[model samples]
Target: MLTALSIRDVVLIEALDLDFNDGLGVLTGETGAGKSILLDALGLALGSRADSGLVRHGTDRARVTASFAPLKAGHAALDLLDEAGIEVEPGEPLVIRREVKRDGGSRGFIADQPASAALLRDVGATLVEIHGQHDERGLLNPRGHRALLDAFGQIDLSSVAQSHGEWRAAETALAEARERLLNDVSEREWLDHSIAEIAALAPEAGEEEALAAARSDMQKGARLVDEMDGVDKLLAGSDGALAQLRAATRRLDRLAAEHPLFAEALAAFDRALIEAGEGEDSLSKAAEALRFDPAELDRIETRLFDLRALARKHRVEADGLAALLEDLTARRAAIDAGEQSLADLESRVARSQSAYRNAAEALHAARVKAAAALDKAVASELAPLKLDAAQFRTAVEPLDQSQWGPHGADRVEFLIATNPGAPFAGLMKIASGGELSRFLLALKVSLAEVGGAGTIIFDEIDRGVGGAVASAIGERLSRLSDSRQLLVVTHSPQVAARGTQHYMIAKTSDGTVARTGVRSLDAGERQEEIARMLSGADITDEARAQAARLMEVV
Candidate 1:
């Protein structure tokens, strides 16, 4: 609730401080008495558009401060402040201040900390609701209708929101899976052919190098085999070097037994034979090792060519072919598994859809029931406000699946019919200005415990109505005030008389400068004011009597 407001050099308000209280507070005065100026000052504090014209004639700047007592714990406004990194201590007042300079620029503060006008406006919305000829929020916007109905019905939307989230998640996963499947379909045939070719070749690690080495050895051995055969014939053929050495060693051994001098010559001859025999044995083994088969050489060359061709086709090194083959095989296996994976994702999407449908159906049912009750309650308040023939409705229309949202699949709107045989239309379209205020009043009274701000200010709700209609408006205001604070600017005597607190706004001049001043009226002062309202500019004895009677009833 707004606890106090201070205006400094704003328009004709030079300097003023007004304290406020809970319940219905009324501001009453004659025309051109600056009641609108007070509202303007309040709007400025609430971050409305700033203008240099709002500054007083001689002042360089104008300021307005609106103070509110601490809101209830967990208020949405406090959460907004927290999100902005602003600190507000518990049990402390929430002071919103705005100042406009003559240069057409303005500044705002919340709780004495610098703030943006946007933030001030957001915070102000949580503290007070202003219903007038041009209010865009509250019961006016159809966007807020669903939440209002939900609050009135005490419906919980957590399950609905949760289900919607799950459904969207499942939907997204399915979309990605389908895209992957489409891409894979284009590559499926290529994958099958490549896997088959790799399997047939059956490339192995180091096989390419091993085959190349054997081919080189066979080519070199073809040249060396002829030289090896020549050396073997030289060492082992008849009458060759080894045969002559063996005959010389036998002659020397027979001579050594007959003559001592031949002993030395026999030993040298035996050594020569031994050396020649070793040379012949080495040549024989070399001739055998140099032998090569033409068929085997052809096979090695063919194997090498096959391996190199496959490596080029796959755009990899000969040694890397085995790894590439393994990778492609894994890809084919994954494609085979994709079918099962797709089935699981489809099942998940179905489950999520069912969950969301169940929750939305339940929410829609509750809203339907609540809409009927709200209509009934609002209809009951219409007759007393002179809208006896008018019908108030809380219309819940079904929405298509594409329009469904986290809230539900229903579009809620407030509708009204001004007279019999009149088709129900939007609240804003069908009602006149005076009728709209009364309708809003009736709606507020019915939804007293539903969606509303802590404080509500109605601008001239009894603008053209008087007599019993004025009395009815006053009574309903009083009733609405039972739950929350209400401030009304009125010219009606009946409405003025119902205020628990009364203020009088008047324009005064000190010869040079004119200013607007507001004062809290005492009991006698209220009587005089009410009397003035009843009898115009003159207050008569009968008017006082009537005022007294009006005050006595409430």
Candidate 2:
């Protein structure tokens, strides 16, 4: 509900402040008493388009601020404010301010936090629905029809939307899988041949390194064997030094028994013989190690060539062939099982589709039932608002497959026929300005508890209607105010008398500057204002009596 409005230098409103209350409040005054100016100021605060002309003469800028306090939680405007990063504490009023400069520049704020006019407009839509003869907000938009209908019927659509999303996800997965299968068909033969070739090779880890070392040894075998044979001949052959050393040692041992110098010579010869035997044993071991068959050397060289060739052909190192073989084998297996996997995916898609179809059908059925109830409910309101001849309808039509959405596979529209025997058409197309306002009111009354802004303002809803018709309009507005705050700008004395709170808009001049002001009417003041509306410029005793009677009825 709008809590307060402050205007500064906006047209004739030099400085004005007005506080609002819950329930129905009506603003009444003589023609050109700045009632429209008050609305313009409110509109500017609600983020309507700005114009430098709106600024008062000689003023640099014009500013308007509006405060709203939603009595209940979970109002849609709160969500919008949250999304915009505007803070509104519990029990705190949300303040929106707009300033238009004489230079045609403008600024806006929500909760004193700087905001864009576009965002302010979005948030304002949830706070107020300004219905008039030329209304474009609220029910005038067809986009919100489905959601409004669902709210009216108390239908919860989260499950249906969730199921639809899941179905789409399943269908997307199946399509991608099928596309992969079709694209890979030409590669099936190539994959099979590669798998077979790699399997036949049976490459082992570290085989390449072992084979290379053995080949290096085989290549050096002939040179190593020749060197060992030369050492063996020098150390133990028939002309070798070992035999000469044995003869010398025997002579030295005999002389040593007679002379001490001989003993030294015999010991030296013994050491020489031990050294020669050690050298011969070392050479024999080397000769055995160097030995290699020609066929074995040939086999090592051929295996090395085979490993290198295969490595090059596969664009990998010889050591990596084993890993490559495993990958090819896995890919081959996948192709072999592709058909069964695709079949399983198809079954899953079918199940998801069935679930989605069931949910959509159920939603469609509920909408049809809800639409009929809504039509009847709105029809009941039409006759009281002086539209007994008008026919109200809720048209539900099936949507094409491509148009089927998360909500449902149906489109809902509000239709009307203002005269008997007239074909029903869109509300905007068939009803005149006055008829449209009444029709909107009837529809609003029917769905008063469904989806509506916290504050609703009707501009001259009683236009061109009088007597009982005016009272009926007032009664409906009052009923609507029971759930939400309502404001009506009217000249009808009966409607003005119905306001829980009455405000009189009047313009005054201080010889140099003219300004607009609004004041809340007290009990006695309200009677005088109503009487003025009843009898025009002259408020007679009879008009006052009638005003008292109207207040008594209220």
Top candidate when judged by lDDT against the true structure: 1
Q: What is the lDDT of candidate 2?
A: 0.87
- Give the distance in Å from residue 444's predicted Cα in candidate 2 to where it truly belongs: 0.9
* Cand. 1 Cα-lDDT: 0.90
TM-score of 2: 0.87
| Cα lDDT tens digits for candidate 1, 1-554 | 99999999999999999999999999998899999999999989997989899999988999999999897788989999999888998999999999999998999999889999899888888888888876766787788888889999999999988999999999899899888777777888997998888778888999999999999999999888877767666666667767777887788888898888799888888887778777777766776787888999999999889889989998999888889889988877778888888899999999998999999999989999999999999999898888999998898998999988788889999999999989998877854787888888998888899856899999899988899999999999999999999999999999999999999999999899888999999999999999999998878999999999999988
Each prediction's whole-model lDDT (CA): 0.90, 0.87
Which candidate number maximizes TM-score? 2
Q: What are the root-mean-square deviations of the candidates from the true structure over C-alphas?
A: 6.4, 3.5
Per-residue lDDT of model 2, residues 1-554, tens digit only: 89999999999988888999999999999888888888878888887899899999999999999998844578777788888888878887889999999999999998899989898889889888898777677887777888889989887787679888988898888888888777666678887777677667777889899999998987788888887767667756567668777887988888898988889888988988888788777777777788889898888888778878888988999889899988877766777788998999999988987888899888888988999999999999888889999999898888887887789788988989999999998866855787888898899998999867888999888888889888899889988899989999998998998899999999998898888889999999999999999999999999999999999998
